[model samples]
Target: MSDLEATKTRYEVLGPLLDERLLRLWAAREARAIGSGGAYQVAAATGMSLKAIQTGLGELDLLEALPDGLPLTPVPGRRSNGQRSQPRVRLPGGGRKWTEDKDPTILPALELLLADEVAGDPMGRQRWVRSSLRHLSERLAAQGHSASPTTVSRLLKGLGFSQKSNKRKLGAVGRCPERDAQFLYIAAQRQTFTAAGLPIVSVDTKKKELIGNFRNGGRSWCRSAPEVDEHDFPSKAVCQAVPFGVYDVTKNAGFVVVGTSYNTPQFAVSAIARWWQAEGRDAYPGADRLLILADGGGGNGSRAGAWKVNLQERLCNRHRLTVTVCHYPPGCSKWNPVEHRLFSQISKNWEGQPLRSLDLMLGYIRGTTTRTGLRVSAELDDATYPKGQKVTRDDLGKVSFKPHADCPIRNYTISPQIADQQA
Candidate 1:
């Protein structure tokens, strides 16, 4: 066909004689078989190549003017494509929403405004974007561009920017309420120390730093250490992990003690003893009983039956906080929100920054914070931690903790030294 005939084929239904490049190319070519036109004649009428007309016919814009209620063909077997080829749209439930044609340029501006407004405030609620767009489009008439506010709004919505007030809203709930509730619960628990005429404080040493050469959890080993055969080599280069602790259920308060050695009961008890003298004492003024919620694994883990024995005598007896302990379920230490709310922030704030100096680590730990708060008490324990010293069972007998009626539930202990020194 001649190019004119090719273009004319597009709008044949409108009339073969009404072929004009500007109108057909702009309006009629926006459809594939739209307004009862065939693609071949559309190329002839619009002067577009038959190939260009054919190519544009399948696009969504071409069919924009088609009546929405028109019957459509059913493509079958989509799910199980063979015997299951069936009328899918007629199948119900998740059918598409029926809507009107909209402008494309309006969508970009709408989305830009919505996203710009939503960036700092995820709760969404920015109506100014829609209002401003409508105003701008209306004012454009004075500036000589023709468009309506309603039309602008429709285009904005089509681009996924909500003209309706619903788009900018936050999720059904935010973390603040839940976190506040938790703080309140923990605060109540802290008060129990007074109810029982005891002083209760959340106590655990911050993860310890090694005083000498040692392996760290994040090491880039040639092979997994756990997979290494016992015969392969000695696992000797392990650095000591530091111990971190919070007090009185206060996310805003806590401290860390750097230990020169951690392999022995003396190192563990001494570090803890120092921590108590430093911060724990201040948490409970005019207090009698000292209840500690500790995991069952660390220096004080139930397994370290000896550490508890030492704490009972050397630590608690000296302070006179009627110390009783409890332990959490095994392998579940992270359930302690303090780790993330407190310790995790500390680690994150300090990553890539070296703990090259003892004071540096102390500085970072004290600076850690959350939406709740930050606090840290730290001291360098340079007096030798007396490694390789073992406290015997006879020594355990000398250490005495004022017993709790329900020791298991009231006081917990844990001591699986972390794989991560900073954890």
Candidate 2:
């Protein structure tokens, strides 16, 4: 048979079994045996480019010239004997060049694109690119850097970047200058109150949940996922649920009052009062002083006059306890113990489960437990709390209120009117 026909027959017999390196080397050996115009003939027969055959022939020459006593290193593929092959597939720096190496300008250009779009903690090692991979690739191409989305992604990973969604890290606009100071003050107060055996409770109104078969956020291990309403329209709900939580810092217990009414100052204070009556008072018996850690912008807000008024009348006067309320700085509510410690657990427990009714939600809250021995109690507060109930200056004056020397607007104490008068 002719050389081309013979080469084709040999390849057809062993082509399926041979890998890239072995195929190239076998073709080179056949070409060398065929003499002049052999490489071109082999390329045409095997459909391998002439460059690959030349590379294989060069490798064969290097193998022959190897100094004696140098151990033959095993490569990745197997030989005809079913043993590891003893030849390097490619020489050093023989494969395709890295995108970064080939186009040095690519990395710098990518960094430039990310400089404006990157969002993460400046001190943190992990950073995320805001632009999509395709968009970034297009931008890179526009800058004369030819790169695919996959290449851009790899480059980003190499540059300590990753895909990340928007995080709620940015604080609210017009952040309080005394934000850090207020946090420190709260910590100090907690220490003091904890030492003195006073009842320290973190209070906050949780996000209002629509009461119905509404879709929840997370997954649950169940036989099947419980179906919920497609759209979360407020009007479709039976009523909104306002869960005002009171988390005991010392006891590691949570008390949540699910209010059907408006989340007014009265509702918030009443929830606190309910918790104290049910759990707090018994947990810290003989504790006359109550330290309340609250956020600065809700029902029990630092600027809410009615919150102070309700705290004085409902909590202090009714229970004959001195209430010290420390408000976390604006936009820093997540730091409140009630948020991360209590509310987060409840949300996790009820995750992906439709809150078909108020009872189901309360059950979920009550069932939530943590590895650190967290216990929770929940109850429905069917009382009507009318919103827009203004607390006039006279009403505020009646409460025995004393602001702290440091961050007075964010920290204050309300004593029982009778106790203040008697003193």
Candidate 3:
């Protein structure tokens, strides 16, 4: 074969396996082997232009001089007047320039505009001025700096500022000293349960969704977007869906029981009971102890009297199982595994789709899956759970429970009092 034909053969063998840089280097090396002005010959054989072959040869020469690990581009002598070192795809400094960089005084002007300096007030009224981006842009223009609202927004972000909405995360009682301690104790309890082959579950009630043709919070890919009611009035809603989720920490499984009525303690315990009867009992046969992780407020709150009483009556007494409860600190419900693992998946499953009927909602929950083998089962609880069902102190005394020494109010275990069951 001719030298050109030999070069073609080498390319055909190594082309698929080699990256762009390696391929270029290989081509240049092959050209060097064929003697002086061999770049023209290699280009003719490979269908690469003579200019590209010459560039490749230049790259090879640079590689010999360059340190082993330095990247091919950004060579010392190759750069010219802010242009890229090499003649390739991307230009040097090719991204959108910061507005603040374009006009240095724009940031300081914005800070002045936002600053609250009342002429006479000692405290200066308020430090934050919530003005529109367009208004700010106009003010900047008046100060001899030309900028659009979009550019102003970009400048603001560069200066560590952003458009923020009201956050309701701060509850009635702010951060507690016992928060970290409770979390650590809960973690320890979970580890103990998991090691002992006992069930550990995170339980929480998902936000109540308005039933019927109401506008959901997200969008889905469809030929055409589904039409929904413009205004979401409670009168127009068919009913509200209260989804109580139970997430199994060990197995990565979820169970959601939807209720049509009030989300009372009775309803919460009932959901747990349903999950135990349907899935838990079969999964862990003869398992006597159940560990529950819950939020500090709402239907299943640590302070809720009805929640414990219902647990005693519906779960402990009826099922003959010891129920250990751990309540997450106030305003920390978002950390609950059920909130993220179960409810988040459910929301994503039925995004932009109207939950017109109970069956549709249940189907969405059941179909929810994750890459980490999350299996979910959902059921509708049509039972009438009456609100305002009070659990007196006398009723609480009847249930036998031992508070953990670490955090008494937050961690406790209610053992079944049945003599035969304990035996």
Candidate 4:
């Protein structure tokens, strides 16, 4: 083959395997191996700039002058000893300098813009920019700082800033002063009950779902997308599915009762009672005490007198077990284990799938499992529970309730009442 063709063929074989430095050196070596005007020929064949080839030739000349047996500049390819040479891709401080270094005021301008509408802890080292990168870029440009959105992103990252969505962390309006104290008390109760090997359950009624062909919030793999109703009208629904979950903290198990009836205190207590009969008793054999973690609002809410009365009748007296109830602070229901562990998994499993029937909803709950060996069981309760059922003072007084010294409203115990127990 001709010299140019030979050079082109060699480069095609080895160019992809070499970095910038190695490519330049290889091109220079090939040019030198050829006679005069070899640089022009190599350049035409390999498409390398003449300056790079000349730089490589200069490096070769320097290498020739150096003494033998001294450590040489590392080469890119494998050595005679079968170990690969570790070489610098470029010398230190090589390549284009960063945008911040080029324009010192760019960082300050970015920070000023971030501070204008910053969210999150002001004192935190890691903060996020509220403005989009494009908007920030435009703002910086208007202020005489020439920066692209990509460059602005890099600079923001260097300054411990990132793009983040709004986190649902802040509490609802009128933050309760006793919120922190209630959390601490709940932690203590968990520790005490866990140490004694008693069953501790986190209970909550999940958001009621309309039973029928409805649009679920997530995507799933299917041959064709399932058609659902355009509008989620209650009148269009066949029924509503209210899933009351009891999550066993120690066992990492879940018991969900799907009720078609109203989510009243009676239904909530009956769900717990069902869990105790189906799984709790068998799991914690001979245990006489139970701990329940619930939210401050709902059918099993701390302030629901009927909730306490039902626990006294169904769980405490009927089962002969002492039930200690702890309610999470207002607007803190997400911290409840049932919400994340059991309910979240069930939501994920059934996402994009229409709950066309009560059976389908129960099936999704029953099939839900987690990587942490979580097992779930679900049952359907077609029984009717009318809402707004009030507990009289006489009935509430008969609960044999004992409020704890700390956060009595959120923490209390209901012991089994004797046959002749006084109000």
**Model number with the top lDDT:** 4
The clash tally of candidate 4 reads: 0
Ranking by lDDT: 4, 2, 3, 1
Tens-digit lDDT track of model 2 for 252-309: 9999999998989999999999998887878888889999988888788889999988
Arranged by TM-score, best first = 4, 3, 2, 1
Worst 10 residues of 4 by lDDT: 116-125
At residue 50, candidate 2 shows an lDDT of 99
The digit string of per-residue lDDT tens for model 3 on 1-423 reads 999899888788887887655667778888899988798888888887776667678878887888878776554324668775553444556656766777777778886665321011111111122467888888888999889999877776664466555557444577879977787687788778988999988898998988888887778899999898889898898888899999998889999999999999999999999999999999999899999999888899898889988898889988988999999888667667787667777887888898887888889989999887999999998888888987778888887778889888988988777765333
RMSD of 4: 14.3
lDDT of prediction 1: 0.49
Q: Which of candidates 2 and 3 reaches a greater TM-score?
A: 3
How much is 139 displaced in model 1, in angstroms? 54
Off by over 4 Å in 4: 1-171
Judging by TM-score against the true structure, name the best candidate: 4
- Candidate 1 C-alpha lDDT tens digits along 347-373: 665544434456666686677665555
Report RMSD for candidate 3: 18.4
Write down the worst ten-residue block by lDDT for model 3: 117-126
Report lDDT (Cα) of residue 275, candidate 2. 91
- Candidate 3: where are CA atoms >4 Å away? 1-173, 419-423
lDDT of 3 at 138: 88
Q: How does each model score on lDDT?
A: 0.49, 0.84, 0.80, 0.85
